[model samples]
Target: MAAFPYYDTPAIDALNAQAVALLKLFAERGYVREEPAVLQPAEIFLDRSGEEIRRRTFTLMDPSGRELCLRPDLTIPICRQVVQEGRKFPARIAYNGLVFRHQPGEPHRATQFFQAGVELLGLEDRAAGETEILSLTIEALRVAGLKQFSLRIGDLALFGALVDALALPDGWRARLKRHFWRAGYVESLLYWLGHGDGKAKLPGTRAEIEALLDARADAPMAGRSREEIISRAMDRAVEAAALHLDPAVADAIAKLLDISGPAEGALISIRALLKTAGINLDPQLAAMDGRLATLKSLGVDPGQVQFTAHFGRNMEYYTGFVFELWARDKEGPVQIAGGGRYDSMMEMLGAKKPVSAIGCAIRTERVLAAKIAGGA
Candidate 1:
C-alpha cells in the first residue's frame, strides 16, 4: 500500500466487507461500536504514548490556537472518549476507523490505515479480559480467511515485579519503567545502577531545581506545576545518592531480558533466574501460568506460543500481558495484530480511578496481504 490508499469501487467494497464482518463479530460479543473524532488534542498523544508514536504524529495549530493532530491510534482516543463521556465501567467498546501517521523515508508504507478492535474497560479480572481479547483477535483473523499464525507473548508486569523485588528508590523505579520500551536505554540504566560514575548528569543544577521548588504561582507549564517538576528533580538527586544496585542484581536483569523460548520453558527459566537472585516472583509467574492455561482452554494451542521476557511492544502504555500475532508472508513473518493490558491508561487519560482494561487492534490491510500470500 502507498502512503495514501486509493482503491477502486470493487476493492473498497471488498475491504468494507471484511471490516463489517469484524464489527459484526465484536457486536455479537457485546462491544458497542463507537466513533471518535479523527481530530484529537495533540498533547494527549505526545504526553501519554511512547516516543515512537510522538515522532510520527502529524500536528498543526488550529484557528483557535490549540494544537490538534489526526488520531495516531484508536486506543488512546477511545479511552479519552470514555473519560470525556463519563462512561460507566465494565464498558465494552468497539471501533473501526482510519488512523494517520507520517512515515518518513518509507513512501511505500501507508500513512493512513484501518484498525478495528475492542476495548474492555473496568474488567476486574485481568486474565479474563486478556483471554477474551486474544481469542477474539485470533478468531477475527481466521474469520477473514487467514490462518497459521504464531503468538509471541510478553508481560511488562514481570519486569515491574523484578524492579519491586530489587527495592530500588522510587525515582529510579519511575525512570526505569518509563524508559523500558526504548531499545538500548534499559542497559544504560542498569549500568548506571551498578556504576554511578557512568551515570549521565542531571539536566539542570541543584540550585535551579530548588529555585523552581521555592517559587509559587506560575501558570500551568505543560500541564504540570512548577512544584511537581522540582520535586521530581529533587527526588532523583536524593535517590541517586541513596543507593547503588548490586552487580548481581544487575546481572539478573540482563539475563532476564535475554530469555526467549517455548512458553512454559521460558517461565521456568525466569522462575529459576529470580530464585537465584534471591527475589521471589512466584505470584507473577503463577499469574502468567494461569493466563496460558486460560488461553489453552479457549483453544489457543500452547505449542504455537513463544514467550520473550523483554518483548514490550513500542507502546509504552502497556502495563502487562502483551502479545503479537505473526503470519508468514513473501518476505517472512509479518505482524498482523498486537495489543495488551494497560490498566493505568484510563487514570492517565483522566479517569477518577484506575480502570482495568485490555484490547487488541487488527491491521486489516496486513490481514489481507497475508491472506493473499498464503493463497487463502
Candidate 2:
C-alpha cells in the first residue's frame, strides 16, 4: 500500500526501541551520545571509504555547486566530526541513526537501516581497544536477544607482517597487501610469485631490474619518464612475476593464509606457521594473547571466536583487528554487526594526528530479522 518499501508503525516502533536499548548500553559505558547530520560531503566517502561504499553512496549537488551524499555508513562521518571539533584524546562516542546505501539484491536487506554503536577513540593500547570493542559488540547483541552467533576475527597487521617477513622486496610486499582481501587472486598470486614463465623473467625477478631499485638508471619515457615506464613495468612485473618466489616461501605463506579455526587452536596453528617461516610476530601475537585474556576476564568465551590469518574485513580502512558477529537464520548465518581497529584512518579523515580507534555498529534491522527467524 505504500509507495516505497519501509517499515509500518509496529516495525518502526520495534526498531526505535532496539536503537534506544543499544544507545542506553553505550551511555552506561561513558560514551556521550551525539546525533550527526544525515547529509555529508561526497568527497570524503569517495576518497577514503573504499570502492564498495563509493559505488553505493547516494550523491547529490547543492545550489551552490557543492557535492553531498547521504551518509553511507556512520563511522567516517563521526571521525570527520572528531576531526572538525578537534576532540581531545580517548573520545567515547555513541551514535544511532539511519544510514543510506544501495543494496541491489536480497529483497529482505534494508536499503536504509538503523545502526547503533560506539566508537572508542585515541586509545594508546591497540589490543585493549580491540578487545573492548569486540566485547561490547557481544554484549550488545546478547542484549538484543540473539541466541546463537559466530564472531570471525582477523588482523591485517599480523598478515601484512608475515608477508613482510618473507623475502619479497617492497614492491612485492605492496602488491600482496593490496590484493590480500580479494578472492582467488591470493592463490594465483602465490603460485605465480613462486613459479612464473619457464624463463621466469618476471620484472622484479628479471636480471635487468635488481630488487626493483635498479629501475632508477632507466631513462624517463613518455608521460612517466622519471623511471615512469620502468616503474610501471616494475609494478606490473611485481604483479605478474611471483615467479621468483622460492617454492618454500610461497607454500609457507599460503599455508599461513589458510589457517582458520576456533580461537582455542587457531592461535596455535598461527604460531606454528609463523615460527616455521622464522617470522617474528611476537609483538602482534603478544597483543593477541593479551586481547584473549581480556576477553576471558570480561566473561566471553575465547573458544567461540574464529580467527583467520588472511581474513581482512570488507572495509579497507581497517589496519589491525577486524570482527563480525553473525546469527543463523532459516536462510543461513547473517552478519548483524561488525567493527575493527583503524589506528591511522582518523588522521586521513582530517585529524591533526592519527588515533587508535575501534568501534562496532549494530544493524538493528538485521538483528530484528534474525531474531524473528530464530523464534525470538
> What TM-score would every model get versus the actual structure?
0.87, 0.84
Best model number under lDDT: 1
In model 1, where do residues sit more than 4 Å from their true spots? Answer: 195-242
TM-score of 1: 0.87
Q: Which pairs clash in the backbone of model 2?
A: 192-242, 193-242, 193-243, 194-242, 220-225, 221-225
Model 2: residue 159 alpha-carbon error in angstroms: 1.0
Candidate 1 lDDT by residue in tens digits, 153-251: 999998887887777867678878777897778877887777775445653566866665557445456787666777777776776766788877787
lDDT of 2 by residue, 180-223 (tens): 75766876777766766343544563446644445555644455
Tell me how candidate 1 scores on lDDT. 0.85
